[model samples]
Target: MAGPVILLVAAFATLVAALLFGGGAAPLVIADAGPVVRWGLPIVKLVVNLAAAGMLGALVLALFALKTGERAFDLALDTASVSAAVFTIGSAVTGFFTFVNVFNAAPSADAVFGDQLGRFLVDTELGRTWLITTIAGAVITVLAFAVRSWTPTLIVALLAAAALVPMGTQGHSGDLANHDIAMVSLVIHIIAAAVWLGGLLLLIVIRPVTDRAPMIAILRRYSAIALAAFVVVAISGTVRATVAVGDLPSLLTPYGGILLVKVAALLGMGLFGAWYRLRLIGRMAADAASRHFWILVTVELALMGIASGAAAALARTAPPSETAPAFVRTPAEQLTDAPVPPELTFDRWFTAWNVDLIWAFVVGFGLFFYLAGVWRLHRRGDRWPVYRTVLWVLGMLLLLWVTCGPVNAYQDYLFSVHMVGHMLLTMAIPLLLVPGSPVTLALRTIRKRDDGTRGGREWIMWAVHTPFAKVVTHPLFAAANFVASLWIFYYTDLFRWSLYDHLGHEWMTVHFLITGYLFVLSLIGIDPVPYRFPYPFRLLTLGGVIAIHAFFGVAIMMQTGLFAAEWFGAMGRTWGPTPIEDQYIGGGAAWSIGEIPALILGVTVAIQWSRSDDRLQRSQDRHADRTGDAELEAYNARLAAMAEKDARAGR
Candidate 1:
């Protein structure tokens, strides 16, 4: 009770102070919505942010920290439900206020005003975003209250996270130079912050009802989660600030100052998290230190409030970066929302860079976790093959390059480069990644939890063994999916979607990677799956896939028409090959460069098949040696009996 009250009071106070300091609520020169609307909008938005955090955080922590069917788990869900209700109301109110601010229309009983408001919600992009957000919030509110089990609760949590997406899209990213990067960073920042802040709030709520032993255990689990959240929050925050501030000189501006205050609050919270992780969590197991832990928690919540306030105020403060230029610079720039790069030279293939922060993080964390797993095995006197580690590192590095390097840098303008990235993502990288046998490493290294609560190890096990996993990892299905993906993605509107939408591009990357990984894993991976094809059948599957894959590429090469002509053809690239020529090159990449890896896979499968036969023959020879050819004697006896029966018949 005291925690929530204290947090809100602190948040409101700081929001008011920051708004005044930043002139966020100052009178606008044009289309001013008056003092009440200006002040009221930010205040309502702040409430929405807090409510979102509480809804999502409680659900996430409940999934990770508390055992199902327990009082603590139920209480966490209850908290989520209550918070979701608040979120639903807050989102609706925020939407109305936004409409008022944008249209400067007063709430009234007139039917004309009603019709206009209805049109605004239906017709405008901003209105649609808010309406969707409100609907998602309302859905989450019901689901959170109705569901208490693991899977259902998890679904609700995901929905709650999705509800935040509209807000992320509504931010200043649309007006920024690095639109994709800014949008992605803001989304990550919002979700991570929600999880961190909401989890702590959940802990505070469930403390009174939970046993001391379980409470401490939950605290320890949450500390791990908080640490991860902090890293994401910090990185995303840095990216957001870098784009928003433009240059160091802008740091002295009002938006920058408000951002600095938020940074300070985050730093303070990080320190408090470190203390709790290293020392306080352990001490809290004892009665003497429990009081101290709660006290510190209160202070940490206050700091979170300050951050929340500063963030809300920052939203209202215009960045020093020049507003998105009014005039179009070029056709490419108009379409891509970015300037065209210099000519595509041979050297640019190696030297060019365009960082996709999402993949960069994925690669970073993937390497870190994989190496950590291997290290754990070594420390336990187990010898994980060194080659696996090397291969995994190579795969991750290649993925990093494909996603964040030259291929990514030029893919938007050059169809050939996009195909190059696709090949690497689907074929080359998966070839290396499968042999690394990441799942095997994880199963061998990650400590299993005896507690009923699900942890990383438990979740991993659950995922791999699920019915859906069985279907996807089946050799025939995986191969079919792998072959079908290339044709489907390249031939459909999905191709255009990937070109025009950042999320769609990310989806393509992940979808291809997974399909390829499943295919390879079924063939030659060391990780255990529900089933694997026999070596001969595996080769047959590979052969079928290669034929289909080649035909798809040939179809593309033979086509006179270009895919996504509006995008690829309209890129206005002067130095690169013509769009049709680039498409041909892309088809060549798919057929020629891509087939090299597929052939490699085929050869590897053949080798494993031969080795399997040799191993079986050795086992039989060892049996003969141990049993002195007993099977041979039995065979001879049976033959002699048949000969004696023939002799008797002749007599």
Candidate 2:
């Protein structure tokens, strides 16, 4: 009760103080929504943010740390359900306030007001975003209350997380210069903060029902999650701030000042976490240490409250550079919300970079975790192949390059470059990734828990053995999906969607990468799977897929018209090939450069097949040596008896 009380009070206190200091919710001189509407909006928004964090974080921790049918698990779900309900109400109120603020609508029971509100909800992007968010919150509320099992809870958690995304798009990010970067950063920031904050609230909520030993265990698991969440939050928040603030001097502005306060609070919380991880958590099972731990936790909660409040205030405050509305100066800027890059050159292929912070972080963490796993194996006196690590590193580096380097820099302006990236993502990178057998490495390295809770290792194992995994990893299905994705993506409205929507582009990248990885894994992966086809069948599958892929490439090459003509044709690129010519080069890259990886897969499979046969023959030879050729003698005697019977028949 004290902890929760302290958190809420501190949060509201900090929020009011910051809003006053920054004049974030100050009444507008030109289009004033009155003090009540102006003040109420940020307040309601704060509630929405906190409720959202509580819902998503508790659900995620429930999945990762709590055992099904346990008291703590049920309590966590109850917390999530209640938080989701608050989130729903908060979102509705926030939407109403937003409508009032944006349209200067007065509170009324008149039919005209109702009609206008209805139109706003259905007719505008802002209205639709909030409507979707509110609906998603309602759905999560019901699902969180109803579902106690892992998979269902996971679904609810995902829905809850998605509900936060609409808010990210609503912020200054949507109309900003680096819209994608800012949006991605905000999305990741909110999600990670929720996990970190909500998990702590869950601990306090569930503390009464848990024994000390189990509580400590749960705390340790949560600490690990918090560590990861904190890293993500810090990184995403930094990127987002960089985008919004624009320059270092902007830190003197109202928004930046509030942002600095939030950063300080976060840093305080980080220090508290370090203290817990390094000293307090280990000794907290004892009485005095337990009391001390709770004291520090309370302080941490207060810091989190300050951070959260400052964040809400910062949201309402305008950045230094956003004093005027963004205006598009060209077709390219209008289409991409960005200026066109300088013409692509051969040197730019290696020198240029347009970093997707998402993939950059992904590659960074991927390398770190993979190497950490290998190091763990070495420390335990276990042997892991050096070649596997090399391949894995190469694959991750290629992924980073494809996602963040020149391929990404020019992909929007040049179809050929986009195709080259697609080829690498779909075919080349997977060839290196599959042979590394990351799953095998993880299983070998990650500590197996005796407790009922699922950790990374347990979850990975569960996912690998699921029925869905079996179907997707099947050789035939994987191959079909791998080849069909290329056609389906390019031929349908999806191509245009990817060009227009940042989320769609990310989805395309993920879909291609997964399909490619699955196909390669089915063909020649060293990782354990539910099923793998025979070597000869694998070769046949590869051959059939190769033929179809080549045909698809040829089909693309033969297209007389441009794909996504509105987007590609409108780029206004003057230095490079024409749209049709670039498309031709893209098609050629698809057919030729892409096939090299397929050939590599085919060759690798052949080598594996040959080795498998050789191993079988060697095993038989060892058996023959142990039996001293007695089976051969018995076969000869049987043949002689058959010959004698034939001779008798002839007489």
Candidate 3:
């Protein structure tokens, strides 16, 4: 109780001070919106952050550590319900203030004001965002009150986390040069911060009710989660700061200075956590040490308040220009949010670079966990195939290149380059990934839980055995999905959506990768599957898929009109081949580069089939050796008996 109260007071004081000193209050005077809307908006948004953190963090702790029917678990849910109620109120208040701030309209019950407000909420992007966030918060508030079980509470937590997305989308990044990257970074940062902050608050709240043993266990689990959150927050914060500060010298600016304060506070919290994990947690069993632990937690909570408050102030501050010499953008730059590069060259494939922070983290975490899994196997004197590791690493590297390199740089403008990336994601990368047998490796390396608690392995196994998995992994279904997506994606509005929306682009990548993976898995994968077609049927399926794929490519090549002409044709590019010619080249690449992986799949399936036959023959030979060819001898005896009966009948 003291910890939370102190945290709130410290945060509020810091926020007020930063706003007055950091130029955040300038808007009130400049816009003449008065103190109520100006001061009230940031304060309400701050409370929204704190309450959202409490709701999400408490739910995370309950899911991971608290047992059902336990006092601590029920109490945690109650805390979540209260926090969600506050979140709902805060979000609503923030939404209303955002309207006043954006429109500079004083609050009134007049029909004119109401009509304007209605239009703002229904028609404008910013208004719609806050409206959605408020609605989501309301839903979570109700669900949190009604739910006490693990799964239901988990759903509420997810909803609560998702509710932050709209707010994240409206951050300063939306106005920046790297809008997509900024949006991704801000969203991840918000969610990770909530989990980290909320978990710490819950720990303090439940300390009195929990026994020492259970408390320690809960602390250990939370420490692991917090460590992960800290890493995400650190990386995401750095990415966001780079965008916000723009250059090194800008750090002396007011906005940058406030950001630095937040960074320093984060560092202090990190150091405190390190000391707690390394020096204090081990001694927590002692009465004197436990007393010191509470003191340490109080100080940590104060530091967290400082960080959160500085963050709120930083949000209110204006960022430096990410684009230098701000000038009118060309149509190409307007569409892509970046300048057109030099003419495409062979060397440019390796030289061109565009950093997508989201995919970078994905690749980094993927590689780290894979290597960790392999190391776990090695330390236990278990043998994992070396090729699998190589293939998985290679696949991830390909994924990184496809997503973050030249392929990503030109995909919006060049149809040929987009096709190259699409083919790699769908065909080449999955060829390597499926052979890695990641699922088998995970099942081998991850420990199983016996206490009816869900863990990584349990969740994975559950996913694999679910009815959805069964249907998706079926050979005929997988083939149909693979073939159908190529048409549905390109011919329908999905193509336009993917071009215009970053989220849709990401979905397209993931969807293609999964469909390709499933197709390959059904054909020649090393991992155990729910079902696989017979070798002959597998060959037939592969052949049919190849034919359809080739026809699809041919259909594109033969088309006279350009697909996605509005996007690809409107890039105003002067250097590349014409859109129609580029589309032809893309079709040719699809027909040619795409077949390489299909050829590999064909040969792999054939080799496996031959190996299957050889194994069967060897098994038969061993049976003959053990039983002296009893079946063959019995057949000969029957022939002799028939001959003897024939001779006796003749006599």
Per-residue lDDT tens digits of candidate 1, residues 413-489? Answer: 98888888998888999999999998889888877888899988888888888898999998889988998888888
lDDT of each: 0.89, 0.90, 0.86
Candidate 2 residues 28-98, lDDT tens each? 88889999887998899889989988999999899988999999999999999999999999989888888
Q: Tell me which residue pairs clash in candidate 3.
A: none
Pairwise TM-score winner, candidates 1 and 3: 1
TM for every model, in the order presented, reads 0.97, 0.97, 0.93
Q: Find the 10 residues in a row with the least total lDDT in model 2.
A: 320-329
Specify the poorest-scoring 10-residue window by lDDT in model 3.
317-326
Q: For residues 188-223, could you state the per-residue lDDT of candidate 3 as single tens digits? A: 898899999999999988888989977887887788
Show the lowest summed lDDT stretch of 10 residues, model 1: 322-331
Q: What lDDT score is found at residue 362 in candidate 2?
A: 88
